[model samples]
Target: MSLVLLLFVLSKGFKGSRVRDVRVRGFGTGGVDTWQTTPSVGWSRIVPKFHAAIVKFDIAYPYGKKHEEYTKLSAAGRGSPELLVAEVGVKDYGDMENMDLAERFGVTKEDFPKVKFFVNGKDKPFDFDGEFNAEELKKFIRRHSEVYIGLEGCLETFDRIVDRFMTTENQSDKKGLLRKAEDEWDKLKSPSDQQIAETYVKIMRKVLEKGGEFISLEKTRVEGLMIGRITKEKKEEMQGRLNVLKSFTHDEL
Candidate 1:
């Protein structure tokens, strides 16, 4: 595939990073099980931009096994603004009426359309494609979307890199590869980020030693479908928020 090089501009003399608020929904039959959301409190620190927070509703147990852990994390400021609302579903009209939620969290029914509920609250309209609102919604969705990874694939890839370094005798090359390996290990749970930085560098150096010119990247689909689908304007507005750096690389023939 063809390669696309992206030109990015960095703000001059900018010392403070933009603090980002992340709203993660683990919706299914049950809102993100409390046990699962607990670990994300620590993981959230890895991305300093995102201040840890949760907006949840329960379809299962009122409280999960790790409920106390999440509560503690929130109390310590590690997980801020963790809203645990139970029996959450798509309450279009009800959500809109609840001025308390709309004004406080800004999480209206329009923001989440997949799930619906019959609740005792004001309902909100789902106006995603209103001409003016369309543009704004597009921008919000792109920045707020989540990134997922396959843990097994990541570990196997890291092990392969470590094995390659163990067999190499050149001191300089060995040092470079091992450093790359450690970086990969740190972000193994995040394949896309690790791919652009650590994985690409390691593979390129290895191929150069073997007199090869082309490199390869394996792309995986969730539910057998491609995930990234932000609108053009949304893409331009969201730069560092969603790092699509790998999209610029050349695909192997």
Candidate 2:
């Protein structure tokens, strides 16, 4: 979808001009790579040579006001049929703040409004704990490629049981699909979508008990999530860890 990235996503944000970071980096065999403010290497070697990259590391100043609002949210966070949402300011790596590229990407300085999801040839990179807008970072890169709406009424059985529980590699094929997703969330029947499909099978059974630190626990807000409603001191501050996951906002969006 190039026509200058479909006119930069129908021009919802940009005050363009001057130098480096109007951005572009899409390589499926060297295709659209541009935007570089002195990076002859080092984003852990240019993010595994891109096939996915969501970096939004800021420190502002290049176009002010948090660098033109994260460069118009990385040009409306591109069209993502794979990924590439870059917008790295950090004062273009000068004024003594690169700190050896933030200690070779372990990130501190309070995780400077972080967002790093790179996945090209993988070298361990994933921590976009959602919500810092840009439409939840384009619904977390389209939930790494669509499928997330289940209450019954199969949608390719929860996206083929989350791509066979993130590409199985044994462990009894990941506990036999975590007991076939708790037997399809016990054949739901809308008791609040069977408690939201048992909180999406308890966050994919804690990502199969944390064996592969995540690629898809998949909750890109399928069908606009809901959590009844809160505020009784946020439901008595979540009535004793009501199974710990919470993010509810419904004012008619």
Candidate 3:
């Protein structure tokens, strides 16, 4: 999709999608695009406040359906041994909240987060020893890459089957060889690694079911991902500098 169209889609969210009530000010003044996305009343109105109580959450709108595709792409697998590719498309870097934790705090492994949600707050127990929460991971999709969360999951069966056909154990086609290697990696991991692999497997299955490989799916993939990225520290710093609409107030909205 064209960059202009992508910006249009992202702007719609800034105006307010179901889970978020957002607004933009001072954007396009100095050749820079800036905006804020805040949760709507529903988030805070939920007795305990979903935003605060929950370590992570997302507001699902028609636009947010891109994430469903992310889950699918992440789990994708090629039936043939010739190809085993998993590519993640980051949304827009500027819009992602966890870039701080994902990058600065060292959570992302390559493109994926090592640990997604930290229960009991970052300061409470401060546990950084586990797998990522899928739902929470969605929040960090870079918001800039049309396909920020894309990944490929391969099964040991797939590689073993390919291995059987190769005249020499390591002599399969380059792509096919990589598939076997990935499968080997999967086998030697702890339960956490296995879970992550399986999550990708499930997502890939879903994508295949929906005919996700079709060009039509790219439209959804490319939406709302044209913004530029600012560092997590910079984002917080900017939020403080600019008086964007705040989600909380003493008076009722």
RMSD of each: 18.1, 16.8, 21.7
Instruction: Assess candidate 2 and give its lDDT.
Output: 0.47
**Residue 26 CA displacement from its true place in model 2, Å:** 20
Q: After superposition, how far is residue 98 of candidate 3 from its true place, in Å?
A: 24
Query: For candidate 2, what is the TM-score?
Result: 0.28
Point out where model 1 deviates above 4 Å: 1-51, 54-90, 93-99, 113-152, 156-175, 179-253
Candidate 1 at 31: error in angstroms? 8.0
Question: Which structure among the candidates has the greatest lDDT?
Answer: 2
Candidate 3 per-residue lDDT over residues 138-222, each given as its tens digit: 2232121112222222233432332232223333353354455456547865774565444333333333344334223432332
Off by over 4 Å in 3: 1-141, 145-187, 213-253
- Measured on C-alpha atoms, candidate 3 has an lDDT of 0.30
Best by TM-score: 2
Per-candidate total of colliding backbone pairs: 14, 0, 18
Writing each residue's lDDT as its tens digit, candidate 2 over 1-253 gives 6423533343323324332332333322223334333233334344444466666655543334543444454555343334555545454344544444544567665677566766664756677775565545544554553412211212335446655666666777767776886788789676755555565466566766774443222223321223546556544433322212221111101
Return the candidate ranking by lDDT, descending: 2, 1, 3
C-alpha lDDT of all candidate models, in order: 0.31, 0.47, 0.30
